[model samples]
Structures are given as structure tokens and as C-alpha cells.
Target: MSAPALERAQVQHRTVRVLALGQVLGGVAFGATVSLGALLAADISGEESLSGFATASVTLGAALCAIPLARLAAARGRRVALTLGNLFALVGIAIVITAAAMRVFPLLLVGVVLIGAGNAGNLQSRFAATDLAESAHRGRDLGVVVWATTVGGVLGPLLLTPGEALGRVVGMPPLTGAYLFSIVAQTAALALYLIALRPDPLLLAQRLARDDARVALPGADVDRPVAARYAMLAVAASHVVMASVMAMTPVHLQHLAHAGHAGHGGATEAVTLLVGITIALHVLGMYGLSPVFGWLADRWGRVRVVLLGQAVLATSLLIASTWPGERMAVVAALFLLGLGWSASTVSGAALLTESTPLAPRPRRQGMSDTLMTASAAVGAVLAGLVLGQWGYGVLALTGLALVALTTLLSPLGRR
Candidate 1:
């Protein structure tokens, strides 16, 4: 409203945009690693079952370090934490390269774990963006950061096709080359973060809050015990459910194909194309409309949007459970899962940002993410066991129940 206020708002906008670009690049590297890591592990180990463990190891590492890493960011600031994250990634890439050269399975898992630690930091970038934004625009800022990830996520898999060829040229496995690309991307991300992400938005917000007491007017007094706890719970629940369904979808689809259920209607290439399309659509649902969801959270109310997300998730799971063998049905289910995830994730993040003061944001964000990732790891591990014994239908039903439970708890969330 005032001239000073208008200038501050402009600065915040610029900061969020710069951070969003860094996040996009980071997300691209992350997307590539996630999309190709399992296949790469399978190639190196020559066992499909072991690949799951390798992939799970990365998530496990992230789960273990999520809170601690966030605390580091909280204490030392984003630049240090992000640089450390990139360093971890570099080390992980080196390990993977060595594993490929020597053909070692255990070493490869260790490498993935390092990469996972880096991922935990990358996940926190959106929160950092929120620290630079006005309370009302928190969701939109977070969404922009998230939207950036889609480009890299889409490009990551496509790179794999060329990455494999490059691998042959370089005398390494195709997937090894992919890891090499991760190294370069992560290094560039780190440089961008350190050079461009200056003055630390959270720190800036904190200073601004101190100078102008009124800055804490909207949703800023959320440091109350009850609100803080509820916000943390919502963030954790949203992340866990999203991670759980995503982890299981591919495995379930693979099972159907193996059972001669899905591919029965088509050739292997067609099935492959169907799977690719499903993943692309799933990604689209996750990141495409995130800004809209954020806008909704700002306008309609955060908790209400989160509840709607949970309800949609439950419905999607129920539908999937009823038609586990149908490809189209599963695709639709995944689309809903992604949409629900987008809503919950964006809204939950905005809620967390609004509820916590600048001082405790990094720590709380870290703790919340750690719990979320841990829950997701548990869900992924359990999904494997559940799918192995009871089949895809049972897994879907189980997820439905979890979503329902989350929905029931939604009332506790901040307004």
C-alpha cells in the first residue's frame, strides 16, 4: 500500500523468481535421478528385486536426514545447506561411478543414499521461496517453485535415452552417464544458489518483520503451540500419502503386466508407451495446476483445500482398487493421485510458512519434511510387502483408508 511496502513487495517477488529457477534446475537433476536410478541399479546388480532396495535406500537416507538437514539450513541458512547438499550429491555420483566401474552393489546403494540426502535439501527450496513472499502470495510462490520441477522431471527421463548412448561412448554403463549428468546439474545448481540466492530470504523476512511489526499481521502469529503442531502434522501427512502412492504405482503396474493382464490387449512397445504416457500424465497432474491450487489456498482457505485434496485422493484410490487390471482405470487413478498431491502439498506448505515465524521456519520445515519422508519410506516398504501378498487391489484399498484418516484430521489445520 505504502511506497516502502510496494518496494519491499517487488523485492520479494524478484527473490522468489530467482529461487524458483534454482529449484527448477535442482528438480530436473532430482527427476532424472529418480526416474533412472532403479533401472540403473537393476542393470548393475543384474537382479530386478535388488533394484527396489537400491531405490528404497535413497528414500530411506532422505527420511533419516530430512529433519537434521532442515535444521542445518535453519541454523546456517539456505546457501550453506544447499551447498552441502550439492557436495553430498557430488560424493554420491563419484560412488556410483566407482560402483559401475567395479560392478559393486553395496557401493551403489551407498551412493544412492548420498543422493537422497541431497534430495531432502532440494525439497526444502519451496519453503525458502515462501520465506521471501507475502503471506497472501505464499501459495503462488511455492507453486512457482514446484512448477519449475516439472520441466526437469520431464527432461530427466528423456535424457536417459541419450544418456545410455553416451554411456557407451564414455565406456561406462548408460545409467552411469546419467549419474554423471546429475553431478554437473547439481554443481551448476549449487553455484546458482550460492551466487544468486543472496541475503537469504528467510533472514530478510525476519529482519523486515522486526523493523515493521505490522508485517506479522496476517497468519504471522501462528507460533502458538497448537497451531505449530497442527501445521507440522498436515505437512507430514500430505507428503507421506503423496510419496506412498507414487512409490507403489509403477510396481503395481509392472505386476499387472507380468500377470498377463495389462499387456494382453497390446504389444510390448504399446505397453511401454502406455506406461510412459501414464507417468507423464501423472507428472502433469502433480505440477501443472499447482499454481491454481496455491491460488485457491490463498482465496478459498488452506485447510479446506487440503481436505478436498484428501477426499479426491480417497476417491481415486477406491476407483483404482475396483479396477486394478485395467490400464485406463489405473491411469485415471494416478492422475487423481497427482492432483490430490498437488493440492495437499501446495496448501500444506503455505500453511506451514504462514503459521511459523521466520526464526523457527527452517527447523520446523526440516522436521516436517523428515517425518514426511520417513512416513513415505515406511509406506513404500509396506506397499511392496502389501502388493507382494495381497495384490494391487488391496494396496489401493489400504491407501484409501489412509487418505480417509488424513481427511478426518484435517479440521485441526490452521485457517
Candidate 2:
């Protein structure tokens, strides 16, 4: 490699490391609060219906914050935006603790919303990974950062019990114990972003791109508007499919197990364990092979990988819908569901990076994320109604239509 190329590669490497660490830390807090939000809401509101809103608030907050955060990253640089995200999370979690102590449900919801702002930061960090990356390695760089989340996401919920234990010792309210860990994890993430993400990858990349533009470097202005449109659609559709199916899996699992047990959960504990394991494996699928998919994206091309994601997601939905009563089928389907999401997301992000102008890239990226989150939220709401009114199989079938639509829109399939 040429000296400049080698240096750029090294800088990209360091940037990815810092981003990965921040992702892990942020994921820890996000995972912890998400795991506990529903339960806390149910306890505080005394209404099961209101419980969903707790989690919904976080999604809404993320959607609400995505554009602003992106704009900030555009104007002020990533370091400022990311650190601000963490600060929002820190303050929000603190408010959650106070709300719990005061027994105020509305206050808790508000706090969780702010926590979601932090999640927007976490999500954007993945794109930041690609800022300094060479086109050939962009997918890999984004993938590594995303893969890092697996560590903290897996560990976050596990900390719940320990957090509760600590809460007891510290005289914290029982329902809000998880927020304590969230505060610490978010703080660490904030500090890491502020301290280690030096010189700002986005800013550096923008300058480089501008210099290249000025010189009229070959392929510098290669535009792929069609591919970018397809990418956005694929990303949004894939997320909808994944979110809708995943939101109802636990409920479906319990119902199926009960039916098998003669309408009585004689193996309730066993069934619960099975559900937990299945979900964990699903999460693994979501993040574990991201590097491999990243490699595929760079090697094969973005649209092809997105097409593969749609195919996998369709198969998963089919299996889930066809054999709703089989636990193993459900597990396999959910795992594929996550894998498909990972493939589509990683590839779609890389495609987005390549398609847009560097100057407006962050803003557009944030806009896409806002749309993705909104689509997922809609899917989640629809999944509940579909599952409740028809059945889990029907819910999966509902998502299958979307999968097919995405397949048709795959850039490889187009002119």
C-alpha cells in the first residue's frame, strides 16, 4: 500500500476501535433499561396496557432525536453530538431513578424518552465507523462496530439481578434498579467518546472527500441514486419485518407451549428457560456473523447482500408461520430473522455511505434512521394486533408480504 493509504487505514482502524468500545458501553445501558422498562411501567402504572408505552417512548425518543443528532454531527462534528447523546442518557436515567423513588409514572416515561436519545447516538456511531473507511473496507468497519454491541447487549440484562442486589444495599427503589447500571454504563460511554474519538472521523473524512472532489479524482463523484433509494427501502422494510416478528415471539412461545402441555403450563419454568435461550440465540444471530456479512457485502456488492437478507427473512417468516407450534422451528426462524436483519442493515448502511455526498451524508443518514425507527414502531404496533386477533402465524404472514416487496425492490432485481 502507498504511505498515505497505509496511514488512512491505520487511522480507520483506531477510529473503529474507539467506536466499538463506545457501542459496547452504550449497548450495555440500552439493553439494561429496555429489559426492565416494561416491568417498571407495569408496576408504576398499575395497568398492563400502559406498559408497552414505556418501551415505545424510547423508540419515539430515538426517532425524534435522530435528525437533530445527525444535524449536530453535520454542523459541530461527531464528537460533540455523541457526547451530547450520552449526557442525555445520563440525565434521563437519573431522572428515572428519581421518578421511581417518587412513584411518578409520567416522570419515568419522560426519562426513558431521553434515554432513547442516547440510543440515537449509539446507532449513529455505526455510520461514523464508515466515515474514514475506504470503500472496499467500509462494510467491515461498520460491521466490527456493530458486532461489538453483542458483548454489552448480552451482558446488560445479566446485570439486572446484580443491579437489583446493589439497589437493595443502597436503598434504591426496586423497580428502578436497572437504571443505576444504565447511568454508569452511559457515563463510561460518554467519557470514552469525548476522550478517545479524537480529531473526529466524520470531519476528517469530509475534508478528504472535499479535497478529492476538488482534484476531480476518478470515481470521486460516482452517484448511485437508484441504489441509495433501494437501500433505504430495504433497510426500513427489513427492520419492520424483524421488529414485528420479534415483538410477539415470547407471547407466541408461551401460548404454543401451553397448548402442547394440555392448556396447563406444567413446564412453565422449562418453557421460560427455552424462550430465554431462543431469544439469546436470536440476538447472537443478529450480531455474531456481522463481520462475515460485512465481508460478503464488500466482496459481493451491497444490493446482492440486501437481496440475500430479504430471502433469508422470507424463509424465516415462512417457517415461523408454517410451524408455529414447534419450539425448534420458532427458534430457528427467529435466529434467521436476526441474521437477515444484520445482513440488510450492514449492507444498507454501507450503500448509504457510498451513495450520498460527504457534506450532507450525516444528515441524510439520520433521516434514514428516523424513518427506519418509525417503520419498526409501526410494525411493532401492528404485530400486537395481528397476534392478538389472528395468531402468531398470521403475524409472520403479515411480515412476509413486506419481505416480498423488499425483494422486488432489491437493486439487483432492478434495471
Candidate 3:
């Protein structure tokens, strides 16, 4: 490789390392919310029905923050933007702790939203990985950052018992313990972003892309805005499909297990264990093997990988729809669903970064993240309703339709 090329590759390597560590820290917060956000809301609100709002608030927070964060990155550089995101998370988790003490519902909502803002940062970090990536390895590097989340995501909930014990000893509110651990984790993430992200990847990449102005690839003359938008849609649609399907899996598993174990002893525990394990496996599918897909995307091409993702999703949903009541079938389908989402999202993001030039990237990328979180927020609400009314089988079919639509859109992203 040329000297300049080697330098860029080295910087990209460091950037990915810092991003991966930050994600592990951020993922702790991400996983913590899944286990407690709703419960805390329900406890503080004194309304079980309103528990869902806790999760919603986080989603809304991420959606609301995406555009602003992107704009900030565009203006100030990624280090500044990412630091702000981590700061929001730190403050947000602190508020959650305070809200628990004060028994205030609204405060808790606000806090979770801020935590969601941090998650929005985590989501953006994937794109940040590509900011300096050579086109050939962009997918692999992005996949590494994406995979790092699996660690904190898994470890966060397991900390609940120990976190709660530590909280109880310190005289914290019942569920506030997790938030306490979250505060430490998020604080570390903030510090990591503030310290390690070095020299700002986005700004550096912009300069480099400007420096190497002569390099051109397939379809370089395509309208920048059109290509960018298509890439955004590909990323956003793939995300919503994953979010919508995964959101309802627990409820589906619960109902199926309940029916199957109506007369069984310890049925509640059995059902919980089943749902937990299945979801964990699904999470594994989403992130564990991402590097493999990333390599495939780099070798096989982006749009083709996107199409492959859709096929995986189609097969997953078909399995789900055909055998919704079967325990093993559902578990397998959920895992495949996660795998498909990983493939689509990873490749779609790579496409997005390359399709839009550096100058316009932050704006388009911001819009992409916003659309992802916003659509996911809406899709989750709708998925719950769909599951309640028509059942898991039909919900799977609906997700299938979404995958098919994304499949059709994938061709547009082709060079």
C-alpha cells in the first residue's frame, strides 16, 4: 500500500478499537434499559399499562437526538459529537436514579430518553467506523464495532442481581441499582469517547477523500442525493423489520409456552427461561457472526449481500409463520431473523457511507439514523398490536412483507 493509504488504514484501526470499547460500555446501558425501563416506569406510574412508555421514551429520545447529533458531528467533528452523546447518557442515568428515589414517573421517562440519546450515539458509531475505512474492508470494520455490543448487552442484565445487591447495601431504591451500575458504565463510555476517539475520524476522512479526489468507482456519476436516500431507505427499512419482529418474539414465546404448559408446575419460571434463552440466542445471531457477513459483503458486493439478507429474512419469517406454535421452530426462526438483520444493516450502512460523499454524509447519515430509530419506535408499537390481534403467525407474515419490500429496494442501491 502507498504511504498515505497505510496511514489511513492505521488510523481506521485505532478508531475501530476505541469505538468497540466504547460500545461495550454503551451496550451496558443499552442492555440495562431492556430489563428495567418498563418496570421502573410501571412502578413509578402506578399503572401497569403505561410501562411500555418507558421503552418508547428511550426510542423517542434516540430518534429525537439522531439528527442533532449528526449535525453536531458534521459541524464540530466526531469526538465532540460522541462526547455529547455520552454526557447525555451520564446525566440521563443519574436522573433515573434520582427519579427512583423521588418516585417520579416523568423524570424517569426523561432520563431513559437521554439514555436513548446515548444509544443513538452507539448506533452512529457504526457509521463512524466507515468514516475512514478503505472501501474493501469497510464492512469488516463496521461489523467489529457492531459485534462489540454483544458483550455489554449480555453482561448488563446479568449484573442485575449483583447490581441490585450492591444497591440494596447502599440503600438505593428497588430497581435503581441497575441504573447505578449503568451510571458507572456510561461514565466510562463517555470518558472513552472523550479520550480515545482521537483526531476525529469523520474530519480526517473528509480531508482524505478531498485529497484523493481523482479516485472513482462504479456509478460515480449517480446523483448524490438520490443514491444517499436509497441507501438510507435500505438501512432504515432493514432495521425496522428486525426491530418489529424481535420486539414481539418474547410475547409470542410467552403465549405459546403458557398454552403448552397450562398444567405444568413452575410454569412461570419455565416460560421466562424459555423466552430469555431464545432472545439471548437471537441477540447472538444479530451480532456474534457479523464479521463473517462483513467479509462476505466486501468480497461479494454490497447490494448483493443486501439481497442475501432479504432472502435470509424471508426464510426466517416463513419458518415463523409456518410453525409459530412450535417452540424449537420459533427459536430457530428468531435466530435466523437476527442473522438477516445483521447482514442487511451492516451492508446497508457501508453502502450509505460510500454512496454519499464526505461533505454531505453527516446530514444523510443523520437522517438515516433518525429514520431508523423513529420507524423502529413506530414499528414496535404496531408489532405489539399485530401480535395481539392476529397472532404471531400473522406478525411474522407482516414482517415478511417488510423484508420483501426491502428486497425490492435493494436493487436501487446497486452500482
Candidate 4:
């Protein structure tokens, strides 16, 4: 290989390493907050109905912040954008801790939104992995960074007991313990990005573009808006389908238990255990084998993998809707759902990175994420309504319809 190529490869390797580490640490905070946010919201509000808003705020925050963060990255660098995001989260966690002590529900909501802003940064890091990557390996690099989140995602909740103990030692409320942990984690991520993410990947890529004008880099000269538009649609649609179904799954299981279905004779503890196991398996599916999917995306092509993902999602919805009362079926459905989400997300992300030009890519990426998060937020809200009014089966059916529509309208099908 030429010297420039070798140098670029080394830089790419170093950049991905730092980004992956950040994902792991950031994932911890996100996992803890997601697991506890709804329960805490319900407790604070003294109203079960308000519990959904906690998660909704996070989603909305991500959508709201995506544009500004992308613009910042566009103007300055990924390091600045990412660090600011983590800082926002750190401050948000501090507020949450304070609100918990004060028993202030609205204040908690404010903090959670900022935490979501941090999530937007975390999401953008995956794209950063691709900025300096070779086209042939883009999927693999993106997948590796995404898979790193699995570590913290799985381990965060397990630390809840210790976190709570730490909270008590510091004279904070027990429930606020997780947020305290989040503060430390967010701070570490912020510092790492600020210090280690030097010679920012995006900026470096821009330089490479200028130095090697004759050399073709992925999406560096693409001027086709229609192609990028299609890619964005695929990303957003898949996210909406995944978020909607996932949001209401636990509630659906609980309703089945109460209705005396397969779990009719089960105790509260038994039901809770079942629900926990199912969710765990689902998360495992989401993160596990992501590298494998990335490989497939490279080998089989991104569009093909995205189509396969749509099929998997459709099958999962079918099984879930048809056998809502069956415990094993529900578990299988959720696992498949996670796998489908991974496939679509990785493939769509790579496709988007490859379809847009470098100059406009940052803002375009931000717009894609904004649309994705916003669509998911809408889907999640509608999911609750669907589950409450009709039933879990109908909700699954609705998701299936969405998948079908999205797939048909996708460039994959049109081409």
C-alpha cells in the first residue's frame, strides 16, 4: 500500500478504538436510565399514565439535538460535537439526582431530555467510524463500534445495587443512584473524546479528499439526492417499526399474565422473571452477532441485507401477533425483532454513509437521525394507544403493515 493509504488506515484504526470505548461507557449510562426512567417517572408523578413521557422526552431530545450537533460537527469537528453532547448528559444526570432528592417530577423530565441529547452523540459516533474507513470495510467498522455498546448495555443494570449504595453514602436518594453513576460515566466519555479524539476523523477525511482529488472515496462526489433520500427512508422506517413493537412488549406480556393465559397460575415474581428473561434475550439478539451482520452487509450488499432485515421483522411480527398468549412464541418473536433491527440499522447506516457526499454528509446524517428518532417517538406513542384500545396482536399487525409499506417504497424494491 502507498504511504498515505497506510497512514489513513492507522488513523482509522485509532479513531475506531476510541469511539468504541466511548460507546461502551456511554451505553452504560443509557441502559441504566432507560431501565429506570419509566418507573421513576411514574413514582415521581404519582400517575402511571405519565410514565411514558419519560422515555418520550429522551427520544424527543435526541431528535431535537441531532441537527445542531451535526452542524457543529460540520463546522468544527466530531470531537467538539461529541464532547459537548456528553457534557450535556453529565449536567442532566446531576439535575436528575437533585430532582430525585427534591421529589420534583418536572425537573427529572428536564434532565432526561438532556441525557437523550448525549444519546444523539453516541449515535453519531458510529458514523464517525466510517468517515475515514475504506468502503469495503465500512460495514465492519461501523458494526464493531455498534457492538461495543453491548458491554455497557448488559452490565449497567447489574451495577444498580452498588450504585444505590454509593448514592446512600453520599446522602442522595436511593432511586437517584443510577443517575450518579451516569454522571461519572458521561464525564469519562466527555474527557476521552476531548483528549483522545484528536485530529478529528471528519476533518482529516476532508484533508485526504483535498490531497487526493483523483482518488475516489466513498460518497465523496455523489450528487444524487434521490438515492440518499431512499437510504434515509429505510433507516427511519426500520427504526420506527423496531421502536413501536419494542415499546409495548413488556406491557403486552403483563396483560397476558393478568388474563390468566399461559402464566395464569404464576406468581408476581414468576411473571417478572419471565419478562426479564425475555427482554434480556431480546437485547442479546440486538447486540450479539452484529459483527456477523456487518460482514454479511459487506459480502451480500447493503440493500440485500436491508431487505432480509425487513423479511425478518415481518416474520417476527407475524409470530407475535398470531401467538401473543404463548410465552415461547413471544420470546422468539422478540429475539427475531432484535436481530432484524440490527441488520437494518447496520446496513442502512452504511448505505447512507456511502450514498452522500462528504461536504453535506454531516448535516444529512443528522437529518436522518432526526427523522429516525422522531418517527420512532411517534410509533412508540401510537403503540401504547394501539395496545390499550385494541390488543397486542393488533399492535404487532400494525408494525407488520409498516414494515411492508417501508420495504415496498424503498429503493431496494424500486430498483
Best by lDDT: 4
Candidate 4 lDDT by residue in tens digits, 54-91: 77767778899999999999889899899989987887
Q: Which digits, one per residue and each the tens of the lDDT, describe model 3 over residues 23-135?
A: 88877776667666755776688864455566667778889999899999988888888888888888888888889999999899899889889878778889889888877
Model number with the top TM-score: 4
TM-score of each: 0.88, 0.87, 0.86, 0.89
Residues 104-125 of candidate 2 have per-residue lDDT tens digits of 9999989988987878888899
Local distance difference test, each candidate = 0.72, 0.78, 0.78, 0.79
For candidate 1, write residues 157-252 as lDDT tens digits: 455545656777888754566565676788888998888877776666666677887554356556754555666666666666656656556655
- Pick the winner on lDDT between candidates 1 and 3: 3
Model 2 stretches astray by more than 4 angstroms: 1-7, 46-51, 98-105, 211-220, 250-278, 322-329, 412-415
Off by over 4 Å in 1: 1-7, 40-51, 174-177, 212-217, 253-276
Candidate 2 to native Cα RMSD, angstroms: 3.4
> Which is better, 3 or 4, measured by lDDT?
4
